[model samples]
Target: MGTDWVEEGSPSSSSVVKTKRLMEGLLLQGKNSAIQLQLLLKNSQDGSDGSGSSSEELLGKILGSFAQGLSLLGSCSESASAGHDRRVSPSSGESGESKRRLNLKDRRGPHKRSKASQTWVKVSSTGEDNHAWRKYGQKMILNSKYPRSYFRCTHKYDQGCKAAKQVQRMEDDPQMFQVTYIGVHTCWDIMKTPRMLIADPDTCVDECFPIKQELREDAKSDLTNDNVPSADFFLITGLGSSDQPNGPASVSSERMGFDDANGDHAVPTMYPFGDVANSHGLEIDSLSFDGDFSFDESEFLASDEVIELRN
Candidate 1:
């Protein structure tokens, strides 16, 4: 390296001298490697034996390695010269890096904040506004498991709305996402629904159910004022312990009304032994036959279930 230094137009004094010496050393290595290959080839020519041919092949690989090293040195020398020629212009407004940053700024355009932002809340739905949003960007958050996605009003560019939002998955629950909003939407963006057309009650009954005119008039009369039921509407079941009726009734007139098997009107059929307990297959021997009917919900349910299953 001390004897092989050649002067070149490299910028740094130390680097220029070191690079020239490095190229010379690599060139010398290549020359020596080539001489070794020539000697091996002579040995191969003397004898066509396995050992002689193997030595030639091995020497050829050594020469190839030296050639690669020389090529690397040549590249370094060219790069050094090119870098020395590259210098900042005195008359230019900015460096190449600053010009590149300006171009990038132009490409990015501008971001304007909202004029008014009064309300903010955390909600569970993506369709929070009912006003549509458009996704803009997604970036990986530092030291966080999930990436955050950015959104803005769909009318941001067209209508000049400045609203922006960032939605990110919560750390504790990956299924839940937290959204942060930056601005309020000023655009008149909303959902449109079909108008509700209500029909008159008389027309609805005429078209839907198609009731007869007489029946429709009777319905209207019944709904206009409360329809009072007759004496037959009151039924008696001997509930005498803790519960009391709204008003007392004569024992003879307090009989329950029962619908006949074949008709709709009340038939007042007499139960077996004048006691309704026998209808449930239960007989009270101690109580008289004229006693009131005692209803048991459990017994009634079980009896209905059995009858239903049998049918």
Candidate 2:
């Protein structure tokens, strides 16, 4: 039975081949449609409307193509599994034994293909996407100066999330990054509530004064004594100070924990209070000094004291 299935004239072999070809065709079609959709979106964003077709129509077509491709892919997987089972099913007689052995051989050398779906997007910053990613690896391409960083979902092991992405800077525009997302997030680890800064006020004082490290000890002492007012203390301890005793210090890509050597740009890591971190884009609400300061939303946003502080 297994031998018959492996034969050129066999229905199973022919069907598998046809299915594989169909899947390839569908994959190509899906890729083309995705590219077209991306172009349309870019055009729309740039305020350049196309003449003939509307974005809604093109979007509908792309969605239909993707849905059809996914259905076909699932069907192909089922067919392959069924064929494998039939080839290895228990049977009687010497021919059956031989067929089982042949099936085992086939299983050892079974055809494999990558079925993971991918999406590519160009963005100004990689960390703008709120999903926590664990950096896995980095590789330098043949003709590229910057190295591409590979990151997987932080909950990959804990929640079985299979989401992964590759981040690489564009050659022409180092400020822009090309991010390629592979696989959908299986883990529903969405952060709904806005993360609040809730740390000891003393510790906040110590961490807040990064500009002058020497002032930290005094700040901590002052915080313990309750000698300095919260607002005045923040202002005095380099919250929005433009002038520095040694030199003017500015937040660079390196300061933000980004790999400047690899052409990575600075991205805001922490958001202000009351702003829920979405999976799509980054938004900030209120500024915090080591999670100790909780000021009014208007005052926080209005003040120039809002600065990215390292934890």
Candidate 3:
């Protein structure tokens, strides 16, 4: 009962292999850069060892982080190699017989090749797409002044979203970043209306912000007739927790409880950008702070139930 659905550009693709090799080369380059930085730091400290001053301390911190990055790069290289072997090994012998059949079968029927469009955008650092992405990995790249940051859909684990992208700072424009997106978002498209969004186990948020952190846990708000969550609802994260300085926010169907009289938990709430947060750190604003990032914000604004920022 195996499926032959190969990823858009698995190790089997020569292009992907070339890209991997390029990435590895970049990792090595980064390691070398780190080593050079350490040497420079050592030379600077030749006259005065253990100054313990702010400059020396800063250099030490930078060098230590670089060393850690080099080690992680070594592990990443090995993992990539191991994954490649796993993907190509079976095709080498009789063990691949069933796999071949499955791949062929997967290519047919519902498993047909997908037309997921891949797009790239050039922008400044901290750039963000319309959707929420969770920072997963950061790697040193070859010849680039800035390290590459890897991000995947925030819903990857929660809603089975597989969209991912890589961001690299441009050498010419250090303040700018290059974002390469891979995979179309199979999840809901912002879900302005409950009818437009298929409710799932995932706590829905606007395309702009995702419900990443639990802001409140014990602080319960009485669900009066007006405050009750019904079919369409969204959740907000990143604001200070209700329990801490911000504390944790909780939902109570009655006056102070987790669920309603029927045992239903509270529906999630959405965060409005500009007024509360800075586009969820997307840095989409052109005017910088004291301004707002413009996108299809109207979608989220249209939803009345999703905009209850403060309880």
RMSD of each: 47.0, 22.9, 23.2
The lDDT per prediction is 0.36, 0.37, 0.37
Cα TM-score per model: 0.27, 0.28, 0.28
Where does candidate 3 stray beyond 4 Å? Answer: 1-117, 189-194, 199-311
Return model 2's CA RMSD, one decimal. 22.9
> Who is ahead in lDDT, 2 or 3?
2
lDDT (0-100) at residue 139 of candidate 1? Answer: 95
Assess the local accuracy of residue 93 in candidate 3 as a C-alpha lDDT between 0 and 100.
43
Query: How much is the lDDT of residue 154 in candidate 1?
Result: 77
Candidate 3 per-residue C-alpha lDDT over 1-311 given as tens digits, one digit per residue, 9 for 90 to 100 = 00011132234556444543543454344334434444554666787553435434443343233223222322333233333312333333445457667555433433322222223233434555446788989999887678999887776545455467678877887766666655434354343323212332121222222111121222223211111222132323222222222322221110111234533344323222222222112221321211222223455445432222222
The collision pairs in model 2 are none
User: 132 in model 3: Cα distance from truth in Å?
Assistant: 1.7
How many backbone clashes does every candidate have? 0, 0, 15
Q: Write the per-residue lDDT of candidate 1 for residues 1-311, one digit (tens) a residue.
A: 11111233344777755654554454445345445644554666788553644544544343333334333333343343442222333433565777666655444433333322221223232414334579988999998899988787776655444556667776776765666555433343222211110111111111111111222232332221101111122222221111222212112232323222322222221211112122112222322213333333354344311110000
Q: What is the full ranking by lDDT, best candidate first?
A: 2, 3, 1
C-alpha RMSD in Å of predicted model 3 compared with the true structure: 23.2
Model 2, range 239-275, lDDT digits (tens) per residue?
1122221111222211112223322221112211111
True-vs-predicted CA distance for residue 274, candidate 1, Å: 79
